[model samples]
Target: MTDASVLEPNAGVTLVPTPNEDDLPRRFSDFATFNEALDYAAQGKRGMNFHDPRGTLKRVYPYSELRDDALDMARRLVAHGIQKGDRVALIAETGPEFAALFCGCVYAGAWPVPLPLPTSFGGKEAYIDQLAVQLASSDPKVLFYPAEIAEMTKAAADRQGCEGITWEDFATGAAPDCALPEAQPDDICYLQYSSGSTRFPHGVAVTHASLLNNLAGHSEGMKIQQSDRCISWLPWYHDMGLVGCFLSLIANQISVDYLKTEDFARRPLAWLDLISRNPGTSCSYSPTFGYDICARRISSQSNVAERFDLSRWRIAGNGADMIRPDVMQGFVNAFAPAGFKASAFLPSYGLAEATLAVTIMPPGEGIRVELVEEERLSGTPRDLSRPARYRAIVNCGKAVKDMAIEIRGESGHVLPDHHIGKVWCKGPSVMVGYFRDPEATEACMQDGWLDTGDMGYLVDGYLFIVGRAKDMIIINGKNHWPQDIEWAVEQLPGFNHGDIAAFSVETETGEESVAVLVHCRVSDPVERQKLHDTIRDKVRSILGHSAIVELVPPRTLPRTSSGKLSRAKAKKQYLSGEIEPIKLAA
Candidate 1:
């Protein structure tokens, strides 16, 4: 294998070798703990590589160097008075430094909490508030971040009365030789804050056993092979990115490439560019919006096959939010000539609460959907007077080994197959509980099964997710999913994914009403009014009811750190008059 340090400039690094049977065997399922998995993986030549926004290789970090640096950092952390079980918050930047520090925390027996970087939608104050809230919740002993965000991190740390240091300083400090803390299977590995969609984010506590078990399941379910490589633009702060892309690859000894989340947002095609360059079978995961953005960006172009080769893209994994069949189909139709197959679309269901994955589609069983009556999905009685509308619900696949999934009604009784209800799961990968929030944890846990807070149903053991229980919008007596309404607005000309937020609001007369806040950019009064009327009429036509459509300026709608629209936050902001709509002439 060529040394990573000697790689030619702009010659994108390849971590996996040409398909060879003599390659070192996979070690993810062979280990009992994360550190053990790293120890074994370090003996191999594979590791992570990072790319610039333009898809050029910038850095190559081999597993051996990672292990060595992590061990040294672990000793330094121990010398710095960071003891076992103490929480250490680190801003999850996609690079070699953060990777080393994260694993170093594991070696030192300090639980590392990965915090998100400021997103494009949220300004500095918003980021500070987000960081402060998470810090206050975890109450970490110290917070480490990249020097670029030192000011914001310090301000958040100051508000929470915790020490804040830059990653460079933290790694450079010398300490007396000391033994690293021993990590056990049951030891807390880290705290993952469920996406920012929540009004108050709860840090999900996952143990070493839970994390490893989930990683093992990922390997077994995907039927990982020697030639498989992963390319991801998912943010490291998110569970799918952190566990599935970063940790899972490390544990399984798979070569992986990364593009910063911000960079990918600007140049979505850079993802495909990197994938086309991979010499071996490629695996990647993204939310539905990611695929939508790519397809839309390349929709008008021709000769796609000449520029890209996606035939080897084995697993185009989808998760982190609702899986849209239309969006997935759009992607496949646009790229089929480029060798991308619809079967490569691997839709799975999971959350941070379950470590990462609850269920995964069997290999090659891609994008299965069942057209069920809308009433069956809403858990509402059918309206005999109206024509039945069928919604295409994507099959998220069967539960991973050792994990059990159940759909339960409101009364907590397990519902029979084909009945839509709260999605629940029991498995070794289930989180212990929310950190420092027993009441919140108790509300979701029932007799060892976790209420996923997602509405879905089972068909012959396959999980089919519909929508979030809390985000469900009820109008009169009918159930409405926010995605259905959001998608309707997106179909309008000039609108894009995440440009609209939908939720339910209580009227003055104590009746529930559908409310929509659309991000509008047009300045003309006539055009703005036309846009509003078009959206309102479209939503009304879809649901057979009127909606209060408020047109706000572009970027007015708030987004979670992971880039998903936060309906709860949007509603709060709207109610507080923070998101003012554009005024029209009388």
Candidate 2:
């Protein structure tokens, strides 16, 4: 695989002609496999472009060149003794090498397991542990990483007792002349590890057919047009990034511009700049925090309309976490001057178990939400004398083609519309099962349906996700979502997204109590106590009860690989004394 660093100069060259006359017609639907989709896309002119931290175009990898390079890498992999059905684990970094290597694995009939790149918050040792754990879970024949992370990768591979080789070294060997093995639709395409929110990450076994079905659904649901292009900074290890942005673009032959995830975190406006600069309609997706960060970054002096032209922005997709209506509205309000429309907000509900998207908000529907009585959300009788509290539930739209969604009660019977219950779905795109973990697989799968472990309701066929069922706080026989408590504390000043985690902790009497962990930066003991009391009071106002508020240092809370706040891990760590709270009283 050619290093993107070598192709940096070609950023100025025009490799493929952008379609100007009309939207390109969909061409790959008839294909049976991902390789077939790539074959069709390679015959076209559209391709993916990579950008540096500063948002400068660094590499232009057209589909045609990508196919040639992938074929070469396929030969090299086979020559190096990577047999069919062998797992080839690759550290997912946004660049040409990973792109080529991933596609090459498909061509070689090998399953590619994408592992997360080391995050800045985790430090080196933590990253090694994470990598080693995932490596052991997948049990890949070999691990591949970029030259930059070779040392860390080697350390992890050695710990897992597996061979590790850099991409450059892996491609250095002689190529075999043998023909590549053909892939069947049911062949395992890759292993996707569910984000760190889970107590234990399970490798999801996704087949080629399942992947293609989801991609086709995404295209159909989005109403893909020739003028549509993608601009994203999402990490490729996660479903939204890998399946939604990277592979979906290839399968659909849509051009894309990528900014590194780290870079986007630093300069989020660069994402908007890419969208503004694109001549075609831009479609981008992000979790609620992404929108919140961008909104907070905007200032009075900044001219949004003059500097950015978001009028062409089409779908501003929201997923990968619980959709916050307030954050979505904040983004629209902040960017409205730049021609960003509220109708462009496309909220969807999905999980990696469903292969990325189970439902997509119908095009042009934007974000339609329903405010239900809080008691209805709790599944208990309402107190009419008390002031009615309302929870804003965003309509996540209908399930995609070939997918069926149901809201099931505790008794395993289907619940009626407007009643909150466990979300279940049956579809062709559903994962076959967890890789080599039938116990985990059987725990979630019942008959042909998957218990999504998420709580939600339906309204005239549209889905409204409430929260993760396991994360629900049960206090005194009533149900409360952790998000409701966390969001309440977030309203306080000096707090930011992901700074709060709410869960239930057991008391000495064996009753569950609401526990809130806050990431605080205040050093003064007086101010820290004030902050803690303020959070407690705010949560009490929302839940009508007191909560145990623990103020920890900043970044103390755990986050998933996809950057979602992990309340489950936070609770475990807090109970285990791993996260020590400040001794304000002392």
Candidate 3:
């Protein structure tokens, strides 16, 4: 490993090393509750910055202001006929408006819900359908959208039989001086919707204290500094964007350069340029596909090598999907000549149920992966010593302070090191429960541990994920799995299964089926057509749905380290035009 000092120049920030893994102090002994921790930051003398490209920068809104704005928003909703605990959906990019609205819900004693920008749908109608489903399930009293989205939001509001309010309209109301309502550490703060990658999303009710505690734990675990800045392109609805990017910055009294999710997709290098131009210790995160896109889309004329200095970037965290080891390396290698440091690649683990972060690899560690036999990792047991092909899977590092992680067997018995099982977590940061789904919630939480539904093992206190338990597709009851389907198609003539992934989806008619999305990896028209049909036929023979194969390019398929396909990431690419779509064999 290189010296932390040596990496500082390339990072463009002063390197402050925390206590080593062996010497670090306890994480949460000082802050008992999330609100207590947030109060500590809110009560601080420092200010916050919500920077935007075209909008005004809110340099410093006192916590008192946040309190007042939240109360005002809450009152406005009530005046519009919303009631306490009524779902209030917010569909805006990350900014003072969204944050204030979320806070307003807290003050109004209503449940605030942050909706992710519509990425799957083409026009306005698909977004309307999505919003309708969320409203039907959540049954929100009111819906709030940014002014730019007002036109489309109206359609959604009309469909849901709910009233819509633009950010401007909400702001016109007088600020409320309503007294701060009493809140329990356990009372719900907001409804965080699921990512909706595989199926219809659910709303997870996160409490004021749960969110705050997770943020506090993230602050300490991530070593977030008060003077730090964050340049983020993550959607506000995603946990990474909401908790990891937004609230973490607020809690640390740091400034954040907030870019719209669309803006980053269109111009990814802008994220790096903004950080370099600002010359602040800034950090941000994205899935493996995001990194691959920037590496592909950002032009060489951008002078990224000379103009951007990544050494100051202390934490280039990767999460929200599987972290790809090669993708991280490729990004570092591509940008290294431009002053980017290798250690900026921070691999992390989290979920919405945990209010975002569960574990974070420390800074300057770069990233590490473990390769164990797939056969040994199968149904029988996790025998690390078995000599199957050892594939490198990225580690999400150790648990934060007060967070305990256990690898448990099917019977809930704790598994030993090198043994894969369900990843269970218990900490102050874990969520209270799933909203309105007591049966589902109970199935996940046992005693204190939250069963993550992910399969992995611990090696030297570091966490390594193998796969998902529920995501497995059981065909013939023999577990017709994702990786196997991808492998089968990748080997077909003219097919690039390395860029091919398979995911199961249920049809509108109600039958469960599978879809295969294959990245073309070729520019020639002849090869592209052959590759598309070849892979599709291969999948059809192996599985049903005759394999809907979308032919994209070499780097199109989303994969994390250990080279496993990320279905959610791949699906997003399919919807975003980064990858081609597929049609089933007629």
Worst 10 residues of 3 by lDDT: 1-10
lDDT tens readout by residue for model 3, 1-586: 1111111122344422211111212233244343344455454433334434432233444444454455566666666666667788888465667777876676566788887566545347756776777776677878888778787887888888987888777677654334445566677878887675223555788876677677767777778653456777777777788877766655545556666776666667777776675555767787777787777665666666676777678888888776667667778767887778888888889888888888889887878887665454545433345434445668898887678899998788999998878999998768777777788789889986899989889988899877677667643333445765776664555543256677766557766567676655466667567666777677765554464556554565654222336677666666567666543334
Q: So what's the TM-score on candidate 2?
A: 0.96
Over 412-508, each residue of candidate 2 has an lDDT whose tens digit, in order, gives 9999998889999999899999999899899999887999999999999999998888888888899988888888888888888899999999988
Between candidates 1 and 2, the TM-score winner: 2
lDDT at 153, model 3: 83
lDDT of 2: 0.87
Model 1, position 177: C-alpha lDDT score:
71
Per-model TM-score versus the true fold: 0.95, 0.96, 0.78
Clashing pairs in 2: 23-226, 24-226
Which candidate leads the pack in TM-score? 2
Instruction: Provide the overall lDDT of each model, using Cα atoms, as 2-decimal numbers.
Output: 0.87, 0.87, 0.67
TM-score of 1: 0.95
Q: Residue 164: error of model 3 in Å?
A: 1.9
Residue pairs with backbone atoms closer than 3 Å in model 1 (clashes): none
